[model samples]
Target: MIKTIIFDFGDVFLNLDKPATARELKKHEISNFSEAMLQKNREYEKGLMTSEEFVEEYCSSFPQLNSEVFTGSWNAILLDFPKHRLEFLKRLKREGKYTLILLSNTNDIHIDWVKENVEFFDEFKNCFDGFHLSQEINLRKPDAEIYEYVLAQHGVTPEETLFIDDTSENTKAAAELGIQVWNIDPAKEDVTDLFTIKKDLF
Candidate 1:
């Protein structure tokens, strides 16, 4: 039986334009992220670097772009949070059948944008019994340690937890640790149909 539910924020609950950031950057003549740039992004997501520091690193690399432009492009990945998803989550929270946990790999600037743009952000956050943001916790997903940390912190057995994410890499990582998962495809499905889609689990 699944006693706890772990959800990924991007695409699972909130909508995202995954290519928007890269597309935006290309417009500024920044076509690709080098390995070092990617590492910096990972560091930022892990809270190893401050937002200011992250922005400065990018600005220094691309001297033509200022902090504001880079920040805007970075945040272009976030789209809208559909109201129906929030309603489904709220209903699930009201039922209180399982321990609800939100585990996301996100940076400060992205979350700051979410807080400002998503009107019901606070209410959505309150639905979770445990809300673990990667940057806030200094841990990001697709890593065994982060999943272990969440399980230990919440005192939930991996076998009794269901992890839902849009990324297959993340879902595969959790599955390897004995946690059940749904690697949802946002293009074909909506999370509101969770129960029907994963009926055997329920």
Candidate 2:
């Protein structure tokens, strides 16, 4: 039985344009991210660097790019948080069947944008029994340590936990630890159909 439910924030609960940031940056003549930039981004997501320092690094690398423009392009990936999803989560919370936990790999700037844009962000957050953000925890997903951390922190057995994520890489990593996972495809599937889609689990 699935006693605990772990959900990924992006693409699962919130809508995201995965290619938006790259597409936006390309318009600024930043064709692709260099190895250094990718490393810096990983560091930034892990809370090794502050938002100011992250923007400064990019601005310094591309002298023509200012902090404001870079930050704008960086946040282009985030889109809307649909009302129905929040309603679904709220309904689940009210049932009090499983321990609902949110596990997301996100940075400070993106979350700040979410807080400003998503009106019901606080209410949505309150639905989770445990909310773990990558930047705040200094750990990002697809890394085994992060999955181990969540399981240990929640005191939940891997066999009894169901982790839902939009990325195959993340879901695969969690599955390796004996946790059941739904590698959801946002384009065709909606999270509100969780019970119907995985009826056997329930």
Candidate 3:
């Protein structure tokens, strides 16, 4: 039986145009997302590098682009958070049937946009018993250690938790630790359908 629920925030909740950032950056003739740049992104996500350092690296790479434009393009992937999903999460919190948690791989730049755009960002967050942000925790998904950290922190057994994420890699990592998972496709499904879609697990 699942006593706890761990959720991923990006596609699972807030809609994201995953390719928007790359597309926008390419327009500025910054076509190469080199291996080093990818590594830097991973470091930024893991909170190993501060936002100032992260932005500086990109600025140095593309001296032609202004910081404001670079920041805007970097945050282009974020989209709207459907109000219905917020209601569904609120209902779940009220029921108190499970310990709800949010585990997201996010960075400061993206989070800043979310806070400003999502009207209920604060309320939506209050619904979770535990909230873990990659930048804040210095950990990220698709890594076994992060999952282990959440499990240990909550004192929840893998078998007793259900982890929902839109990324297959992330779900795969969680499953390795014996946790139940729902690797959702945001294009075809919505988080609000959790009860009906994953009824077997519930």
What are the models' TM-scores? 0.98, 0.99, 0.98
Where model 1 places Cα greater than 4 Å from the true spot, the runs are none
Separately for all candidates shown, the number of backbone clashes (residues 3 or more apart, or on different chains) is: 0, 0, 0
Give Cα-based local distance difference scores for all models: 0.94, 0.95, 0.93
C-alpha lDDT of candidate 1 relative to the true structure: 0.94
Alpha carbon lDDT of residue 172, candidate 1?
A: 99
> Residue 188 of candidate 2: its Cα lDDT?
96
Least accurate 10 contiguous residues by lDDT in model 1: 25-34
Residue 121 accuracy (lDDT) in model 1: 97
- Candidate 2 Cα misplacement greater than 4 A, ranges: none
Candidate 3: C-alpha RMSD to true structure equals 0.7
**Candidate 2 lDDT by residue in tens digits, 1-202:** 8899999999998999999998988888988778989999999999999999999999999887999899999999999998999999999999999999999999999999999999999999999999999999999999999999999998999999999999999999999999999999999999999999988898
Candidate 2 residue pairs in clash (backbone atoms < 3 Å): none
- What digit string (tens of lDDT, one per residue) describes model 3 on residues 18-115? 99998999898877778989999999999999888999999998898878989999999999898998999999999999999999999998999999
Tens digits of lDDT, candidate 1, 21-69 = 9999999899977999999999999999999999999999999889999
The reply for model 3, stretches above 4 Å from the true place, is none
